[model samples]
Target chain A: MTGPGQMLRRPLNPYLAALVSAVVLIGTLALAIEQRAAILRDGREILLKTEPVDPRDLMRGDYVRLGYTDLSSIDETLVTGPWPDRDTTIPVWLTLAPGEDGAFVARSASFSRPETVAAEEVVLKSLPVRVTVAQPSGGLNAIGRLEFGIERYYVPEGEGLEIEKAQNQGRTTVAVRISPDGAPQIARLMIDGETLYEEPLY
Target chain B: MLRRYLSRELDQWTRSGLLAPGQAQVLLADHDRRYTGFSLSAVLAVLAAVLFGAAVIALIAANWEVIPRATRVIALLILLMAGLAAAAVAVRRGAPWVAEAALVFTLLCYGAGIALVAQMYHLSGDETGFMLTWAVGALVVSFAFASAMAAAGAGLLGFGYLLAVQDLFSGSGTNPQDLSSYATVLALAFAVGVAAWRSRSAIAGHLSALLLISWVMWVIFETTELEPGYVLAALGAVAFGAGSFTPSPLTGTISRHGAVSAYGAVMLLSGLGLIQVSLVDPGLGVEMALAAFILVVSVAVLAVAGGENRLVRRFAYFAFACETLYVVGETLGSLLGSFGFLFLGGVALAVMAFAVTKIEKRFKKGEARP
Candidate 1:
């Protein structure tokens, strides 16, 4: 399309390129903020019992790792479907209802989504995880453990160890906000029924 | 870069009488008019932008409790917007180097914002997820700006993501998201590769290649169920085969200058060497076979693309030297001891020197004829 005297190729319009760059970056920030805000505003609140653990993140600061008691293991008795023989990671649908102690616990776990959600029940989607079910006599009933992504509670610097100590004493609880899509985010950390830290959605 | 190439060619043309001296100066002037030569100040401006970006990330990590979270988030967004707006102005003013640097700064701000926001909100996802998000954002900026620097940024981000994934998987329990993480890393690599090709950035392309190779190595290292050496050797073979035989689509639209094939050959040879080292009770025959394979591939690479591809030539030379020494040690060491091995190595080097001289002559003759 060009003679030897002309340029080899047409250059992209710099103005348009710059404009698109700005818009893309702005859109990314907006999307992140919007998602967090929506979860903070409209998600349902649920309290989870936590055990003791601690870790540090360079960028996210210090944190106490939260492992829920009931959610830790969906025992072979809790699994509602046929367990596969080979080791595998699969998505689990957990049906949650208030337990005798007033803390939400897994009522039924299934490979497929439950067909119904009762008015008082909440079904949360768990991240795909390796099901450590022992294939004993029959495959009809198998119990295993599953961990959702809501595990860590990031606290301010030098505060993680105290929370971990409280958690070890069975005095720590996590307040989570479950979005409509079954995604749960840690909303607050409570020890001995006193609110120690409340996460702000920025 | 274009100016350097044109000036060299112009000198030859003027000396050969293909261009009058007056005409040569006119052509040189015209080229100079169209292209901006390298400027130290412009480089400093970009360097400053990078430093600024790093400072912003460091500031976020510092966790300034004095500033409210809402204010920090708003400030980050505003900084990103301001950087982009300045870039747009630079573009309109016909300063592309400045614009690219500004875009890089903006992408950095966006990444810092993501990390800080995640920290503020107590998001519990792994570092892999954070890096993937950052890489994707950098890739978006790269594509939108058509900036090779931004493309290089994307490539670097993808590499960081792979390293994070390796860290995430190196711990005790099996990673349930292993497959997904690998897929995401590969996809990120491909995206950066695309950006590199689009921008004709060789450095970015090479970085993408490094990411792919590292991902394969990490996967092989994580699961010992599969032999790392054989898997890497097979992967290298496939990559080299695709790069050498399948021309158009396999090579994509990039002018790689046989770089992919060169990288594949390095992987192949390195894997074979690893196998030889890991062989516990191998007979002399197996060791001899590995030595032969390494020698043949290195020689073939040197012969085929040695003149055109500098990377291939250098790696080939190094591999050939190492394989020769290894073979010598295995065979002659037991008989003649270490001194004899050194003597044989010296002789082998002489032979290599002779062969290199002959090849150089042939290449020069071929160039002269053409």
Candidate 2:
């Protein structure tokens, strides 16, 4: 019981209270930021020559699901090997060698050696690099509220919902990086090969 | 004394017209006058038997569709009738033993009905409808019979319903098990409290507070690798913090449990988040900043606001120390690691051991003195 004597004995520290609340707010924000950076820095990957499909969600808004090319034959543990630079299936940059058909294909990954015995056909397996993206413009053209950790990007729900409407009538194809999570929760959203919606879970 | 308290609370019902003033007067007089030859403990035992019997049997009945539906329905109705008769006898007599037995039997009837419904609807996984159904019946019985046990059963049923909704319906994004679940459960608990408070039953108030605290601790201390239950953790922290200041034993117990839980959960979550952040994306300066802020503020508030309350102060102190250690460890990972993580772990174990010993000694000495 807080007796009258005890209640009147002390005053609380305002600076401490403010500091704690500030810390909670800042911590929440920073955790958010670090998560974004992880999505940007490590959680994303490039899938060359892929397709996009619009998916509808009854819960948690709406978005698109991206289907990327399959990666078979991975070392499972990429800590050391020819792809020594590879870490978790997180994203990095990769340059695609294009063909006349506009379908860019590659013989090997950026991390593969050029100094090996002889040059042979290398069908682009796994690229140990991040893919550079084209940024879009205008509120009319932007994807909004994109989430879900699909490799390259998760379709933003706002724009994703809108696109889901359009794509229900049609389908679009775009290159995407698929996370090892069976599906990337949401790395970023893409539109017409442009990086639009993006985020990373730390 | 109990009669007077009950009359005061019962007055509200009379005013609200749920009971006639005459009926209220009669009930109050009867409660004061009757001697059921049954002790309160015996009544409580009967009530427990009824609730447990009903819940268990209902769960059994849930799978009893192989029997004819008509037969099942008939059996359920029979159970309900028996329960109602038992309740009538208990109410008319005003004996705690009979009241408890009646309440338990009624609960059994409720449970049987729940089973039949589950069987009928083939309700798999989601237990909300069952709990909701039971809660409504229990509520009616509690008010009609003025049974605290009935109120408690209803509260538990309602709490279960909340848990089911969150567990069965949470989405893929924005963790369902986070602060939202705790919020929902707490709201339900508060409603139960109000119901109990209106009854002016100490038993009701005590039970409500006890359950509320447990839920608070559960919310605050959940630290699975699942990552995001922390939102609940924050809400729980606030809830428990508020709870600690209340002048109720039920609330006090919850506060102590919740404070310790929140402290432990934050420790685990922070460390896990850090390791994950580093492994996935190293050098996360902002993550550190955010974690630090949450730690410093929560500890400070508990400490400064809590003042001389030994339990609250002790919990706050622990949180402060733990978070400080986190910062220190993160800042001096190399130094700690050079001595080895195992070595640090050993030191932690030793410190804990010493603290435990000192606490026991103090407790023993205090007891001896008294």
Candidate 3:
């Protein structure tokens, strides 16, 4: 090993540099794989209700923008506790319960995790989203919006339009695998209880 | 090119009995033995490596769903290991270009693997997250290998990360006034600039400079009510003044060059011109004043650094020429006035050309005296 200045003066050992490069590449791949495998193996399964909007990502290709009914459009009615009235990069926990159609819906949402949980209730977590309360209506029941990271369902190219069309007819549902840590992964896209696409955990 | 010119001069010197034939041959040999540029084989080897890397990425993006997830991961691991092993052998064989290119392929595989895993696992991340990961990986590789190509990649990825951050942070439905994300971009630009400087890659350094300047302008626009064009003009003026007139404390800490002065002069002139265009009501008086200031600055920069700094000279010439055309476009209200200005401009240019020729002769005579 050399001093940082001396390292710049002379060329690095190619073998060592190459070895470090290989370790980083393999390490990233392994970490991603292990993370996904944990979710797929030990995570609980739940059915999330979603409506689709057409969108495209340049790198990941086309996707049916998954607009979760419970998470995408959180209102004052769903929130059980005091909502944050300023900009925050904090996760809000939503306790989930089975709705009329046996699909999971938000029973109570809070900026902090609820201490008590019912026997049949599950909790889903959101990624860090900025929550801002409008100035005039900064009250307990202020109608504020929430954004969750589990918003997009990437599909193969040219398959988004069909999903959106089916979603328009109220025939689409998302099967999500919630990790033990409350992180949700989109597992499958179901149209009329038939599996359209099942995601592979790499 | 330098070697050829010097070799010819040495031949003439030898013929004129300024040096012996042995000394001329020795000088030519010394010059020829020095490693000045990459060989054709080295260039082609790097090109081949880049093409192969692109192919690997495309193969992964094809998303062979039929393959088991474990199998795809294993395959990528194997490819990554193989690339490193081959690079190691290339290093031993003294093929530095091949070694560097293999490292590039390894880095590309790392990115493709990350994207593939995200796609397979249905991970909820945006382009910003993806770009940050890729850029950090490239930067680490750049540092480890001291690779110029990797440094360039890191610089480009840093820019992509900045753009993605802007897109992701702004339209997140909440916190529309969150300008704090710019701090992350500033930090990224500084790191990439350091990597570029460490690699001694001029192209990456230029890209990083552009990134830093753009970030400054963005911060000025977001935080203050000042017009960015005017602020940029003032910034460029300060940078040029500092680099040219003041002794840089960075002379011992880092390399110093006259290029900073040239870069600053270009930015100052361009920013000033842009500010004029951004003016809402630039009246005739203001327009004429602006025109005069631009002309004076252009000439002053040309006279100050025109001999040593080619970039400054070129930008000054461009600004001067463009301002002259702009003045003609603005003052040409009547046909008679247009003809009169055209005649005046012609005479002025002729006199300027005579002065330039005289200066050129003086410079040549001064050089001949040495």
Output the number of the TM-score-best candidate: 3
Question: Taking the tens digit of each residue's C-alpha lDDT, what string does model 2 give over B1-370?
Answer: 5666888889999999999769998887788676333466785778577666767574444344356545665565555555555656555555555655656675666566555443332222235545665666665555555556667776877667766654543331223234564566676677567656544456666557655755654554443344344444454455555554445756644554344444443343444344434444446496577557656655554444444345554555465556555655676666767566556756765785586567556645755785
The DockQ-derived docking category for candidate 2 is incorrect
Shift in Å, residue B317, candidate 2: 4.6
Per-residue alpha-carbon lDDT of model 1 for A40-131, expressed as tens digits? 77899888888644333222246667778778676556667665554555668888888776678888888767888898788788766555
Better of 1 and 2 by lDDT: 1
Indicate the residue-level lDDT of B240 in model 3: 75
lDDT of the structure predicted as candidate 3: 0.74
Rank all candidate structures by their DockQ, best first, as comma-separated numbers: 3, 1, 2
DockQ of 2: 0.01
Per-residue CA lDDT of model 3 for B191-285, tens digit only, reads 77877877777877887888898888766665567887788778888777766665667654322327777777988898889987887897989
Point out the worst 10-residue segment of candidate 1 chain B by lDDT: B167-176
C-alpha lDDT values of all predictions: 0.76, 0.47, 0.74
Candidate 1 per-residue lDDT, tens place, B25-103, comes to 8998987776563577778888889999999998887667778888988898889988877887887888878987897
Per-residue alpha-carbon lDDT of candidate 3 for residues A116-141, written as tens digits (9 for 90 to 100) = 88878878887655565555756344
Candidate 3 scores an fnat of 0.51
- Among the numbered candidates, top DockQ falls to 3
